[model samples]
Target: MLIDEMLHLFYPRVCTGCHSLLAPKERGICPECIASFDAFSDADAAGYAVKEVFRRNYPASNQPESAWTLYRFHKNDRLQRVVHAMKYEGVHRLGNVFGTLLAEMIAGSTAAAAFSCIVPVPLNRLKVVERTYNQSEVIARAVAGVLRKDVCTDLVVCKNHTRPQAGLSLRERHSNVKDAFTPSGNVVPENILLVDDVLTTGSTATAVMRALESAGARQISLATVVLAA
Candidate 1:
């Protein structure tokens, strides 16, 4: 304990959100910063507002029946700082923290009981090569641990590197990710909980879910750490 304290004196850690010096037990963002995040659902549950997200962005036939996102992501906010740190700044552990928080909100929900397995949305090969990790996979693993469900990491994969969906129109976004993902094998899943870092237009998620459906995924639900408006 003394040695750890001395090392911290020389090299202090800081919160990602506020950039304040961190206590030993604290991880990426401080508790206050997490509390300050704007939530889509105020009821402290993994609310169903993402259902509307799916309805608005996805084709009626391809819409994800249910979905959940932890934080409402906005520009230049604490949640954004946390996301940038997790996604780009190499603070990979933040994904686990957010996933755990998400699981807490989802533990007793219908989605928790309905999902037979968890599958993280696969990352582009280039991003994985650059980051050396998949943030969504880390999030899925943590969620699976809490939910006591199996995680299927090998079933779905990106078949092509699609263009970035940022700044694209809804039609363009759908066209970009279409046919980008495909199932890897014939094994079927009863109910899949698809996990990802963030949700924007739902185009990417829709494409992946369609692939899973083609591969015999019975019913698919979406889970994300952040929802970008």
Candidate 2:
């Protein structure tokens, strides 16, 4: 505890959202910034959104059981600022903090408890290299820490690196990640919670979902740091 306090004294951390000094209890964003987040965080609503993404991918397939996100994504907003820190500004620990909080929302719920394993959406090799870490994996581990579940990183692998999904039309986004992911041959077919940093169009998430399903996953749930409209 003393070491931690000294470290904080030497390298104070700032909230990603407002660039304010983070208090001792805060990890990524401050309490005021957190309270300022737009509140569409209902689990039921997120579950519906998850099912909707599944339907878009496989209209006839069994829909996902639960989907949960902590905040609504708005361009140039607080959520976006935190996302930028995790994805671009090299503050990857923000994902860990948020993922733990994300899991806490549904901790004991049946839908959350049913998952046999947590799988982070695999990043392409190039992106992992550029980012220095897989933000999704960092998030997934934090969630696993809270949920007491195993995080399986190898269940899915990125097969191809494509153009960034940002600014792409829906169709273009889908095309970009089409065939971008493949499940490892040793899939367990267990109930799995797929974790990601953000769900924009969900093209990437849906593609990975298809791969997981193809690999014989029994049931799937979706969790993200934020739900992008």
Candidate 3:
């Protein structure tokens, strides 16, 4: 506890969106960035980019349903930094901040009660060993805690350590992730919430959804902290 205080004192938490130190009652992003983020919320442009992936993969009847996101990912923008810090810089606490916002969104959705379990998009075994944690699981645990839902961190496993999906075309991304995830034979409940830190091309989520479908999960919904618009 004492060490934590000293760290915060020396490194006052800065808003990832604005790089400004947070004020009382403010967090991860500042007021100005919050306002700037609102313009990207058009459901088709920001939220349903995931749906677009589904359009390509399956007919409308076969596509999985999805939920929206909280913010947009601007390349070189503060939201990008926010995701970077959480994923690569050891700033894991932001998962709670992101997860709280996520839970609030989930609470208002019709599928809220349908969710019987929370499962994070899994990280590769090598990456997990290197990072010492999975950012998706961190966020999922926090969201599950707030909603009083069970988390199945060990249910889905990333068996292969492949290249990072960034800068890859959607086709390449889809090819790279094929069969990357497998379930551990856990009986997936009827409804499961799939959590991730970012939704870029939605290929990862789509792949995970297919794996869950094979495992017999009837419904799946995707949630993320930021969506690349």
State the displacement of the C-alpha of residue 46, model 3, in Å, after optimal TM-score superposition. 5.9
Q: After superposition, how far is residue 16 of candidate 3 from its true place, in Å?
A: 3.2
lDDT of 2 by residue, 1-229 (tens): 7877778788998888888898766677788887888755577776677567667755755666678888877888877877878887778668877888888876957887788999999999999898788899999999999999999988888979888888898889989998999888875656999899988777888888889988898788888888785
**Sort order, TM-score high to low:** 2, 1, 3
Report how far off residue 16 is in candidate 2 (Å): 1.3
The residue-level lDDT of candidate 1 at 137 comes to 91
Model 1 pairs whose backbones collide: none
Superposed by TM-score, candidate 1 places the C-alpha of residue 28 at a distance from the truth, in angstroms, of 0.6
Q: By how many angstroms RMSD does model 2 differ from the true structure?
A: 1.7
Error of 2 at 22 (Å): 1.6
TM-score (C-alpha, index-matched) for candidate 1: 0.91
- Tens digits of per-residue lDDT for model 1, 1-229: 8877777789888888898988876777788888899975642344456667776666364665566778888888778778878987788769889889888777857667888799999988887888888899999999999999988888888878787777898889988998899899959687889998988888888888988999898788788889884
lDDT of 3 by residue, 172-199 (tens): 8888998798887888777888899988
